[model samples]
Target: MSEVLEGVEKAEAEAVQIREKAQSQVEEIQRDAERKARGIEQIVRTQLTKEIEALQKSVESKAKNKSQRILLKADEEAVSLEEQGTKNIKKTVDIIIKGVYAFGGGGK
Candidate 1:
């Protein structure tokens, strides 16, 4: 009877030890998972920041290039208008001179 009691006690002790070991393993796994999650969060944040910065730079570059093109086009249009004005003025002066010569008396 005493031997049977001793076997029961030993079995109970082993069960308690197994429960404690399982609990410790569970805690360790939880801690490891938390650490990994933090690492992944940081990596994602860094990548997002980089992507945003790159996009901002690209937009700025495009805006600058567009502005430059607009300025150049405006300059070209102004020059074309100036040349056209000069040509019109010259034509007006030539017509006036010929009319005055005709009025001053007929040329032989």
Candidate 2:
């Protein structure tokens, strides 16, 4: 009966030790999982930042190109209007001179 009691005590101690070890292992696993999750989060954030920057540059480049095309077209239109105005100058002047002579009751 004394030996049987000793055996039971030893078994209980061993079971306690096993439980402690398992608890320690679980804590370690949780810590490792948290560390890995932080690392993955950092990587995803970095990738997203890079993609956003690239997109901003692409949009800026496209806007610049569009603005350049519009400016060039406006400049061309201004030049065309200037040329037309120059071409009409002689006729405009002649008409003005004829009107002045008629208003003065003089021969042209």
Top lDDT model: 2
* Candidate 1 lDDT (Cα, 0 to 1): 0.93
Q: In angstroms, how far off is 32's CA in candidate 2?
A: 3.2
lDDT for each residue of candidate 2 in 20-48, tens digit (9 for 90 to 100): 99999999999999999989988999999
lDDT measured at residue 38 in model 2 versus the true structure, 0 to 100: 84
The list of candidate 2 runs beyond 4 A from truth reads 35-42, 90-108
At residue 46, candidate 1 shows an lDDT of: 96
lDDT value, candidate 2, whole model: 0.96
Q: Report the poorest 10 consecutive residues by lDDT, candidate 2.
A: 99-108
- Reference-based lDDT, each prediction: 0.93, 0.96
State, as a TM-score between 0 and 1, how close model 2 is to the true structure: 0.61
- State residue 28's C-alpha deviation in candidate 2, in Å: 2.2
